[model samples]
Target chain A: MHGKKLALKITSYCFLCLFSLFFLFPFVVMFLRSFFTATESLAIGSGLIPKVFYPKSYLDALDPDFLKYTGNTVIVIIANVVGKPLTAAMAAYAFVKVRFKGRKLIFYTAMCTIMLPAILTMIPVYKIFVDLGWNNTLLPLTVPAFFGGGFLNIFLTMQFIRSLPKDMDEAAIIDGANILQLMFRITFPLIMPVIVLVAVQSFFGAWNDFMGPLTYITDERLLTIPVGIYNKFFTAVSPLEAQPNVQMATGVIIMIPPIIIFCLFQKQLVDGVTFTGLKA
Target chain B: MNKNTKYKDILKTGKTLAALKSNITGYLLILPLLIGLIIFTIYPLLLSLYNSFYLDYDGFNNYSEFEFGFGNYIKAFSGYESKLFFKSVGITFSYAVIMVPLGLVLSFAVALFLNQKIRGMVVFRLIYYIPCLIPSIVNAIVFGYIFNSEDYGLMNTFFASIGIPAREFFYSASSEAVVTFAVMSLFGVGGAMLIWLAGLKSIPQSYYEAATLEGSGYFTQLFKITVPLCTPYIFYQLITSVIGTIQICDQVYVLTSEGGRDYSLLFYGVYIYREFQRNNFGYSAALAYMLFIVIAILSAILFRFNKYVYYEGDN
Candidate 1:
């Protein structure tokens, strides 16, 4: 029995190592590829290691246009990070807490949006964005998030809010606190972890958002990191000056901020996403 | 005494009115989201339902003037493109089948390991999540390079070293390119792992501690307690996995041969994109709506899974 247990432990560790490597391999390839110079990179192929740690790729992606793209990404993410959750939280709070006639119907309409898939709305939404002449700007990226509910976050916040004892409101009212004060002081503080989780999730969503920015923002000056790297990586029918090293660099650069964010909040991020009291 | 009673009643009515005023104020706070949802989200969804009924000779030019009819819907199923519709749907469903379960299993394994009380936990967790943060296009491009056919790709070199002949892993995923498709899917395990890590943590210590006291080994504990308790996260991952995979076009589009010889790896999202590339917006929209319907229907079906789901402490 002891021998059998020892074997199981060893096998588990081996499996973990193999799977961990499998998960880590692509990023290693990405980072290693980013370090090889153009000629050396083209020659070394997709080797596991670089013959020389050339740093030119980073410099290449640091162009004026690249900075502009980063700015564009930041701008779009800021809009979404601020807009999406505020919209979702307010909508969720009102739905779960506020008592009103037609509340259930309106909330259901919002909930139904999640399963609809963003595909169905693409053409029509794009058309309206075009008609408003807001297609080229970052408006297309930010504006929709402001209006829409992140069904997941709203559901999360709703769960969090539901778990709270409603007696807090009665106590607040006894102290003559209004609804705004109720949210800001009493409720918001209680649900800070959920709020942070929603914010970080939104940050990741907006930062990694490609399809919206790809469809809407066409101006070379206004492209985000994903769009910029995409253009450099392929010309589709024609392979114009493909820079694998530079593309890797851009990928690395674009990937860094979120990685930092993830690492910084790793503990919270992990625990925050756990279904604390969720239905299994 | 009567005069005092009437004054007290008046004071009570005034307090009741104040409560009603706060309720209206709550509505005011949520109004922007409602307005935006109506203009950008709600109306467009309704419009898709409307347009799916009518084929506009000039839907783009005169959408407001178009009359509603069911010709488009019927044609969608029995139209010339009906076979294509069914084909895309089949491709999407199959893709979801492979992606969802595979991602969940891989993620669960990684999360289980990472959740251990071990050294270098942070580094492994950080490294594992890196790919999820990378743009999908770049993931495709890098994988594209490694799978590049013509004996140049990393796969060909590695295979040759093992005495296997150089195979075209990208040009056509035939039997030769199957490895490439599997590898492509592996790059996305990070997203699921992060969520799984979250799930692993939430498996309250009581279950494991109790299992230990009962002398059950780790595997039994894992199978019985960890797996059962983590169903919420598993279900969440499964749904998103299905959604992501159904629209699995970006990597295929960015990485493989333009013609993608034999077209074995041509997923549904890529096919719609190809249509769009060919200026077939109407067809693309039609195709997209088909996916939308599948996702909606699947989710609705899964909503029934609530009966099986185990909410903690409920028993």
Candidate 2:
């Protein structure tokens, strides 16, 4: 029995290690190739690591165009990251704490939007934006966040708030706090962890958003990073295409902020995601 | 006695007034979200439904008058352009049929393995989930390079090192494109795995202990206890993955040039996008409605299986 248990443990470890390596290999290759010289990048049978360390690829990738796109992306990201949580938290607070008729009906209606895929809304939303003269600007991409963000964020925030004690609300009410004060002063501070999770998730969503930016932003100068990268590689005949290292470097640059955020808030993110899946 | 009853009636009215006041405050609090929903979600949904039945435009640049009927839907079903729509539906169905189950099983297995007691398990979990942290566009681009149909591609290089022949993935025939898409979907299995892990964690240890006391082995316990209890999570995964896979666009767009050879990789989402680009707004709206219907039907079917899902604390 002891020998069998030992064998099982050994096998499990080996399996995990192998799978982990498979998961990490692409990232490893991408990171290493980002440092390769242009010639080395295209060379047949070149090793994973660069022959000579090259830092110029990063510089080459960050031209004025790329910087402009990065700036646009940062603006959208800030709007989304800050706006989404605030709106979601307020909506969630209403659902959880407020004594209202038809609250369940309203909350369910909001939750049902999760099932309504974004594809269904794409054309009409685009037309609306175009008609409003908001197309080619970041307004269409970021403004909706200030209203309600996504249904998932609001749902998650509501779940977190539901798990908190109701005594806090009673305490605040007894202390002569109004409904808005109860939400903003007491409940918001208590649910800060979920708010952080929402902010991080929203930041990533805005940063990596392709379809929204692709549809709304038509001008080159107004493009965000994802659309910019797509245009650079696929749409236009940019000089960077021949330099694979610089392309990889651009990818690495775009990838860094999200990775850093993930590293810093992995626990809250995992908890929030799992909370969403299991609880929902 | 009449005075006392009158005093009670006034107290009751005052209490009802306070309730009414709070209800209005509650509505005010959620008013912003409700307004957004109406404008962005509900109104657009209704408009799309209406547009699907009409021909509103001539081409990409022309804005013609609308003829309200089922003309666009008829065009999508039996007209000359119907062939592409049907083909996209078929492709999307097959992709979802393969991708959803494969992702579920693989992610479940990973979660099970990772749940084992081991040192540095948290670190390992994070490492595994790192791929999901990479933005979708970047993930697609990196995978495109890795699976590029060249001798220098990462996949081809690895196969060659293992004495296997190189296989064209994204640039291959239709069947191989399906395989490539499935492989690409696997990269984000970490997200599903995390959910599965949470499901596993939520299962009480007492149940497993009880199973062990009854002389059940690991496999038996897994099949009988773990799988049954985790069915809720699995069902959630199933519904969402089906919806997600059917609407897959970003990766396909990034990987394929001009919709791949012979439109083999033209997914439902991409087809809708193309129709929009051609200014076939009504036609695209029809396609979108069709997608919505399919997802609703699939979800309805899955919900029927809730009978088999074991929920604790429910009699």
Q: Write the per-residue lDDT of candidate 1 for residues B97-215, one digit (tens) a residue.
A: 77678778977877887887766778877777777766666676677667766454677767767778777776763634544676677767877888888778777788788889999
Query: Per-candidate TM vs. native?
Result: 0.89, 0.94
User: Candidate 1 residues A1-280, lDDT tens each?
Assistant: 7999678667767776776788677667778888877665555234657777788889997888889888888888888778876777787788777775567777777767767666567667876787889877878887777775466777777788887998989999999987778887888788877777777878887776666666677677788777776765676443325776777777777778888888877776777665333443
Candidate 2 lDDT by residue in tens digits, B22-140: 89888887887988989899999997887787774433343346777878778877866788888888898888877788888999999999998888788889888878877676776
In model 2 chain A, which range of ten residues has the least summed lDDT?
A: A233-242
Error of 2 at A217 (Å): 1.0
Chain B fold agreement for model 2, TM-score? 0.91
lDDT digits (tens) for residues A130-149 of candidate 2: 88889968898889888877
Those runs of model 1 whose alpha carbons end farther than 4 Å from true positions after fitting are A1-11, A44-46, A165-168, A236-240, A275-277, B1-16, B56-59, B63-86, B173-179, B256-263, B276-281
Deviation from native of the Cα of residue B233 in model 2, angstroms: 0.8
Each prediction's DockQ?
0.52, 0.64
Clashes of each: 1, 0
